[model samples]
Target: MEEYFSAVRKMEQTVMFPSLLQGVSLGDLANTLDSSSNEKDLYESYTLLKSIKTMVEDGLVPLNQTFPVATQMKEQEIKEEEDLESLFYYHVSSLYRILTRLTRRAKAVTSKYDEIMGQMNQNEKRLSF
Candidate 1:
Protein backbone atom coordinates (compact mmCIF):
# COMPACT_ATOMS: atom_id res chain seq x y z
CA MET A 1 0.00 0.00 0.00
CA GLU A 2 2.87 2.33 0.79
CA GLU A 3 4.36 1.53 -2.59
CA TYR A 4 1.07 2.22 -4.29
CA PHE A 5 0.66 5.59 -2.59
CA SER A 6 4.23 6.51 -3.35
CA ALA A 7 3.80 5.59 -7.02
CA VAL A 8 0.58 7.61 -7.35
CA ARG A 9 2.05 10.60 -5.57
CA LYS A 10 5.07 10.49 -7.80
CA MET A 11 3.00 10.33 -10.95
CA GLU A 12 0.73 13.15 -9.82
CA GLN A 13 3.54 15.47 -8.86
CA THR A 14 6.02 14.64 -11.58
CA VAL A 15 3.95 13.82 -14.63
CA MET A 16 0.18 14.23 -14.54
CA PHE A 17 -0.18 17.77 -13.18
CA PRO A 18 2.78 19.18 -15.03
CA SER A 19 1.57 17.79 -18.32
CA LEU A 20 -1.93 19.10 -17.74
CA LEU A 21 -0.79 22.64 -16.96
CA GLN A 22 2.04 22.68 -19.48
CA GLY A 23 0.51 24.72 -22.30
CA VAL A 24 -1.68 26.97 -20.18
CA SER A 25 0.10 30.25 -20.65
CA LEU A 26 -0.62 33.35 -18.59
CA GLY A 27 -1.61 35.10 -21.82
CA ASP A 28 -4.33 32.55 -22.37
CA LEU A 29 -5.77 33.16 -18.93
CA ALA A 30 -5.60 36.94 -19.24
CA ASN A 31 -7.09 37.16 -22.71
CA THR A 32 -9.85 34.62 -22.16
CA LEU A 33 -10.74 35.57 -18.61
CA ASP A 34 -14.50 35.74 -19.15
CA SER A 35 -14.80 33.96 -22.48
CA SER A 36 -15.88 30.47 -23.46
CA SER A 37 -12.20 29.59 -23.84
CA ASN A 38 -11.55 30.35 -20.19
CA GLU A 39 -14.55 28.29 -19.14
CA LYS A 40 -13.28 25.39 -21.21
CA ASP A 41 -9.88 25.60 -19.54
CA LEU A 42 -11.42 25.70 -16.08
CA TYR A 43 -13.64 22.72 -16.90
CA GLU A 44 -10.67 20.72 -18.07
CA SER A 45 -8.73 21.60 -14.96
CA TYR A 46 -11.61 20.60 -12.72
CA THR A 47 -12.03 17.32 -14.54
CA LEU A 48 -8.38 16.46 -14.15
CA LEU A 49 -8.48 17.22 -10.45
CA LYS A 50 -11.61 15.13 -10.07
CA SER A 51 -9.94 12.23 -11.87
CA ILE A 52 -6.92 12.45 -9.59
CA LYS A 53 -9.11 12.42 -6.49
CA THR A 54 -10.94 9.32 -7.77
CA MET A 55 -7.67 7.54 -8.47
CA VAL A 56 -6.39 8.20 -4.98
CA GLU A 57 -9.63 7.03 -3.40
CA ASP A 58 -9.64 3.87 -5.47
CA GLY A 59 -6.08 3.10 -4.46
CA LEU A 60 -7.01 3.54 -0.79
CA VAL A 61 -9.94 1.06 -0.84
CA PRO A 62 -7.73 -2.03 -0.77
CA LEU A 63 -5.43 -0.49 1.81
CA ASN A 64 -8.43 0.12 4.06
CA GLN A 65 -8.91 -3.63 4.44
CA THR A 66 -5.33 -4.23 5.58
CA PHE A 67 -5.63 -2.54 8.99
CA PRO A 68 -6.74 -5.74 10.72
CA VAL A 69 -3.95 -7.69 9.08
CA ALA A 70 -1.43 -5.09 10.26
CA THR A 71 -2.51 -5.57 13.89
CA GLN A 72 -1.76 -9.30 13.67
CA MET A 73 1.78 -8.91 12.33
CA LYS A 74 5.12 -9.35 14.18
CA GLU A 75 7.06 -6.42 15.72
CA GLN A 76 9.12 -5.44 12.67
CA GLU A 77 6.19 -5.94 10.37
CA ILE A 78 4.00 -3.93 12.72
CA LYS A 79 6.43 -1.01 12.53
CA GLU A 80 6.33 -1.21 8.76
CA GLU A 81 2.58 -1.19 8.91
CA GLU A 82 2.60 1.96 11.02
CA ASP A 83 4.87 3.64 8.52
CA LEU A 84 2.64 2.68 5.64
CA GLU A 85 -0.41 3.93 7.50
CA SER A 86 1.17 7.32 8.06
CA LEU A 87 2.23 7.56 4.43
CA PHE A 88 -1.23 6.70 3.20
CA TYR A 89 -2.88 9.25 5.47
CA TYR A 90 -0.44 11.90 4.40
CA HIS A 91 -1.25 11.35 0.72
CA VAL A 92 -4.96 11.42 1.46
CA SER A 93 -4.71 14.72 3.29
CA SER A 94 -2.58 16.27 0.59
CA LEU A 95 -5.05 15.25 -2.08
CA TYR A 96 -7.91 16.65 -0.04
CA ARG A 97 -6.21 20.02 0.26
CA ILE A 98 -5.53 20.09 -3.45
CA LEU A 99 -9.12 19.24 -4.31
CA THR A 100 -10.45 21.92 -2.01
CA ARG A 101 -8.30 24.54 -3.62
CA LEU A 102 -9.29 23.41 -7.08
CA THR A 103 -12.95 23.62 -6.16
CA ARG A 104 -12.54 27.19 -4.95
CA ARG A 105 -10.73 28.18 -8.11
CA ALA A 106 -13.48 26.72 -10.25
CA LYS A 107 -16.09 28.69 -8.35
CA ALA A 108 -14.17 31.89 -8.77
CA VAL A 109 -13.85 31.30 -12.49
CA THR A 110 -17.56 30.75 -12.82
CA SER A 111 -18.37 33.88 -10.88
CA LYS A 112 -16.08 35.96 -13.01
CA TYR A 113 -17.70 34.61 -16.15
CA ASP A 114 -21.18 35.41 -14.92
CA GLU A 115 -20.17 38.92 -13.93
CA ILE A 116 -18.78 39.58 -17.43
CA MET A 117 -21.89 38.29 -19.11
CA GLY A 118 -24.08 40.47 -16.92
CA GLN A 119 -22.05 43.53 -17.86
CA MET A 120 -22.28 42.68 -21.55
CA ASN A 121 -26.05 42.30 -21.33
CA GLN A 122 -26.41 45.71 -19.65
CA ASN A 123 -24.26 47.30 -22.35
CA GLU A 124 -26.32 45.69 -25.08
CA LYS A 125 -29.56 47.01 -23.53
CA ARG A 126 -28.19 50.56 -23.38
CA LEU A 127 -27.00 50.38 -27.02
CA SER A 128 -30.39 49.20 -28.35
CA PHE A 129 -31.31 52.74 -29.46
Candidate 2:
Protein backbone atom coordinates (compact mmCIF):
# COMPACT_ATOMS: atom_id res chain seq x y z
CA MET A 1 0.00 0.00 0.00
CA GLU A 2 2.80 2.39 0.75
CA GLU A 3 4.26 1.71 -2.66
CA TYR A 4 0.89 2.31 -4.21
CA PHE A 5 0.53 5.65 -2.46
CA SER A 6 4.06 6.54 -3.49
CA ALA A 7 3.29 5.73 -7.10
CA VAL A 8 0.11 7.77 -7.02
CA ARG A 9 1.91 10.74 -5.50
CA LYS A 10 4.63 10.48 -8.10
CA MET A 11 2.09 10.35 -10.86
CA GLU A 12 0.34 13.38 -9.40
CA GLN A 13 3.60 15.29 -9.39
CA THR A 14 4.41 14.18 -12.91
CA VAL A 15 1.00 15.29 -14.16
CA MET A 16 1.20 18.63 -12.37
CA PHE A 17 4.60 19.61 -13.70
CA PRO A 18 3.74 18.99 -17.34
CA SER A 19 0.56 21.04 -17.00
CA LEU A 20 2.58 23.86 -15.45
CA LEU A 21 5.19 23.64 -18.17
CA GLN A 22 2.46 23.71 -20.80
CA GLY A 23 1.05 26.88 -19.27
CA VAL A 24 4.49 28.42 -19.44
CA SER A 25 4.79 27.41 -23.06
CA LEU A 26 1.42 28.92 -23.84
CA GLY A 27 2.49 32.19 -22.24
CA ASP A 28 5.70 32.22 -24.21
CA LEU A 29 3.79 31.55 -27.39
CA ALA A 30 1.43 34.41 -26.63
CA ASN A 31 4.39 36.70 -26.09
CA THR A 32 5.83 35.59 -29.40
CA LEU A 33 2.59 36.40 -31.16
CA ASP A 34 2.46 39.81 -29.49
CA SER A 35 5.79 40.77 -31.08
CA SER A 36 5.29 38.93 -34.37
CA SER A 37 5.82 41.09 -37.48
CA ASN A 38 3.41 39.31 -39.85
CA GLU A 39 -0.39 39.44 -39.54
CA LYS A 40 -1.01 35.90 -40.76
CA ASP A 41 1.67 34.53 -38.48
CA LEU A 42 0.13 36.38 -35.57
CA TYR A 43 -3.29 34.86 -36.24
CA GLU A 44 -1.84 31.36 -36.50
CA SER A 45 0.16 31.84 -33.35
CA TYR A 46 -2.96 33.02 -31.55
CA THR A 47 -4.80 29.89 -32.63
CA LEU A 48 -1.95 27.68 -31.50
CA LEU A 49 -1.81 29.61 -28.25
CA LYS A 50 -5.50 28.93 -27.59
CA SER A 51 -5.05 25.24 -28.23
CA ILE A 52 -2.16 25.11 -25.78
CA LYS A 53 -4.28 26.79 -23.14
CA THR A 54 -6.97 24.18 -23.59
CA MET A 55 -4.41 21.40 -23.27
CA VAL A 56 -2.99 22.83 -20.07
CA GLU A 57 -6.43 23.17 -18.52
CA ASP A 58 -7.36 19.66 -19.55
CA GLY A 59 -4.16 18.25 -18.07
CA LEU A 60 -4.80 19.80 -14.67
CA VAL A 61 -7.94 17.82 -13.85
CA PRO A 62 -6.30 14.42 -13.30
CA LEU A 63 -3.47 15.95 -11.32
CA ASN A 64 -6.03 17.23 -8.83
CA GLN A 65 -7.45 13.80 -7.80
CA THR A 66 -5.00 10.91 -7.42
CA PHE A 67 -5.79 7.52 -5.84
CA PRO A 68 -3.55 4.87 -4.33
CA VAL A 69 -3.72 1.75 -6.53
CA ALA A 70 -2.81 -0.91 -3.95
CA THR A 71 -5.74 -0.31 -1.67
CA GLN A 72 -7.88 -2.82 -3.53
CA MET A 73 -5.37 -5.68 -3.24
CA LYS A 74 -5.12 -5.16 0.49
CA GLU A 75 -8.86 -5.15 0.90
CA GLN A 76 -9.23 -8.20 -1.25
CA GLU A 77 -6.73 -10.10 0.88
CA ILE A 78 -8.48 -9.09 4.04
CA LYS A 79 -11.82 -10.15 2.65
CA GLU A 80 -10.50 -13.61 1.75
CA GLU A 81 -8.67 -14.27 5.01
CA GLU A 82 -11.13 -12.87 7.51
CA ASP A 83 -14.48 -13.51 5.81
CA LEU A 84 -15.27 -9.83 6.17
CA GLU A 85 -17.69 -9.17 3.38
CA SER A 86 -18.75 -5.74 4.65
CA LEU A 87 -15.24 -4.36 4.88
CA PHE A 88 -14.52 -5.67 1.43
CA TYR A 89 -17.71 -4.19 0.17
CA TYR A 90 -16.87 -0.79 1.58
CA HIS A 91 -13.13 -0.41 1.01
CA VAL A 92 -12.84 -2.30 -2.25
CA SER A 93 -15.95 -0.66 -3.63
CA SER A 94 -14.67 2.77 -2.64
CA LEU A 95 -11.41 2.07 -4.42
CA TYR A 96 -13.30 0.98 -7.49
CA ARG A 97 -15.31 4.18 -7.42
CA ILE A 98 -12.22 6.30 -7.14
CA LEU A 99 -10.53 4.36 -9.91
CA THR A 100 -13.51 4.79 -12.20
CA ARG A 101 -13.68 8.51 -11.46
CA LEU A 102 -10.02 9.00 -12.21
CA THR A 103 -10.22 6.92 -15.35
CA ARG A 104 -13.16 8.91 -16.64
CA ARG A 105 -11.40 12.17 -15.84
CA ALA A 106 -8.26 11.02 -17.66
CA LYS A 107 -10.31 10.00 -20.66
CA ALA A 108 -12.00 13.38 -20.73
CA VAL A 109 -8.66 15.16 -20.53
CA THR A 110 -7.34 13.00 -23.36
CA SER A 111 -10.36 13.84 -25.47
CA LYS A 112 -9.82 17.53 -24.83
CA TYR A 113 -6.14 17.26 -25.72
CA ASP A 114 -7.04 15.43 -28.94
CA GLU A 115 -9.51 18.14 -29.83
CA ILE A 116 -6.87 20.81 -29.24
CA MET A 117 -4.36 18.90 -31.35
CA GLY A 118 -6.91 18.65 -34.13
CA GLN A 119 -7.48 22.38 -33.95
CA MET A 120 -3.74 22.97 -34.04
CA ASN A 121 -3.43 20.77 -37.11
CA GLN A 122 -6.23 22.61 -38.86
CA ASN A 123 -4.53 25.90 -38.08
CA GLU A 124 -1.25 24.57 -39.42
CA LYS A 125 -2.98 23.65 -42.65
CA ARG A 126 -4.25 27.19 -43.03
CA LEU A 127 -0.98 28.89 -42.05
CA SER A 128 0.07 29.27 -45.69
CA PHE A 129 -2.97 31.42 -46.38
Worst 10-residue lDDT window, candidate 1: 14-23
In candidate 1, what are the lDDT values of residues 1-129, reduced to their tens digit? 344344334434433333344344324455433342343454455445447557666665454466664557545554667588786786689767655544544444344444555776799999996
Could you give candidate 2's per-residue lDDT for residues 45-119 as a string of tens digits? 233333534554466446335446555665666657676777669778886664444333333333344455677
For model 1, the superposed segments whose C-alpha errors exceed 4 Å read: 1-82
Which ten residues in a row are the worst by lDDT in model 2?
17-26
Candidate 2: regions farther than 4 A off: 1-83
Q: For every candidate structure, what is the RMSD over all alpha carbons to the true structure, in angstroms?
A: 13.0, 16.0
What is the lDDT for 64 in model 1? 48
